[model samples]
Target: MKRIWIIGLWIGFTLLCNPIQAQVINKPIVVLDPGHGGVDSGAISINGVLEKDIVLEVGKETIRLNRELFGNSLDIQLTRYKDILFSFDL
Candidate 1:
């Protein structure tokens, strides 16, 4: 009937007018893991560039650039900050 049609139209209009805020993420999480550490020296280039050192440097730079470029909007985490090893027994 016309009453049912009107009710349906009213419900549709109400739903459409409301904003759908499913999820609002303020900041994203990121974990940068640089392979190899301590005694375990990873790949080495012919020019004596260590892979572990390079990856670590890259991770550091990424954090720095993210802060400088994006105003530190992301939650960045690094595994190791120095030339040391970490036990992964857990």
Candidate 2:
């Protein structure tokens, strides 16, 4: 009937107009690369501090802060967690 058709159209229009939120949200990924390790020391500060050590500590601190502040919502990855040389093969 014509009345049934109009009711169906009105229902469809209402559904289309309603705002819908996405069910799945992709988490953001972050890669932290601390330069230099093992025998390769990136730079030497005037105070005799190694760049590799400093960078590694900084990377760790950043991860810690993110977890503490943002509940570790991001997928964070570290290139090297300790004093070891990593090979970059392109």
Candidate 3:
């Protein structure tokens, strides 16, 4: 029984330490845009809910779901992880 347990542990450890390879595809990179942020505050609902806040929340959720489904095989990038002001002049 002890020998079986030791072998099981060894097998588990080996699998855990094994590295996973990501599959690459010849496709255009995906750009996620979570728009509206900073002091501007694009739109405000009747309940005082801000559009910027909603957009950011939805964007994060989408990213989480995509990563779970695709694993490390996908190359995903987001424009802004947090609220930030954008200037046209700059």
Candidate 4:
């Protein structure tokens, strides 16, 4: 299933980049950054929930909801796909 999805993504990318395309399809790019990592977790709740974890979860859910409910209109990208601090040099 994952392989199929990857192939589909590759095909889509190729089609989008092809010079024979008739016109450009404009889609809004949305970037969600999950903050805090390494030694920092931002704020911590009484229940031991970290702000970094919360923000990551929120970012993931926002992407899912946008895709499932919004007809996949936006191009969503998540910074630092895993649990890590974001850096321009990284």
Best by lDDT: 2
**lDDT tens digits, residues 1-90, model 2?**
999999999988876776341211355789999989999999999999999999999999989988899887777789999999988799
Top-TM-score candidate index: 2
**Against the unseen true structure, what C-alpha lDDT does each candidate score?**
0.84, 0.86, 0.75, 0.81
Question: In candidate 1, what are the lDDT values of residues 1-62, reduced to their tens digit?
Answer: 99999999998887677644212145677998997888878999999988989989999999
Model 3, position 62: C-alpha lDDT score = 75
On residues 1-90, what C-alpha lDDT tens digit does candidate 4 reach at each position?
999999999998998788444332476788877888656799999999998888888888889998899977787888856678866684
Q: Each prediction's Cα RMSD?
A: 9.9, 9.4, 8.9, 10.5
TM-score of each: 0.67, 0.68, 0.62, 0.66
* Over 4 Å off, model 1: 1-25
Task: Order the candidates by lDDT, highest first.
Answer: 2, 1, 4, 3
Q: Point out the higher-scoring one by lDDT: 3 or 4.
A: 4
What lDDT score goes with residue 40 in model 4? 79
Number of clashing pairs, model 2?
Answer: 0
lDDT of 2: 0.86
Q: Candidate 1 clash total?
A: 0
Model 4 misplaced stretches (Cα beyond 4 Å): 1-25, 88-90
Runs in model 2 deviating more than 4 A are 1-25
> Which candidate do you rate higher for TM-score, 1 or 3?
1
Candidate 3 backbone collisions, by pair: none
User: Where in model 3 is the C-alpha error above 4 Å?
Assistant: 1-28
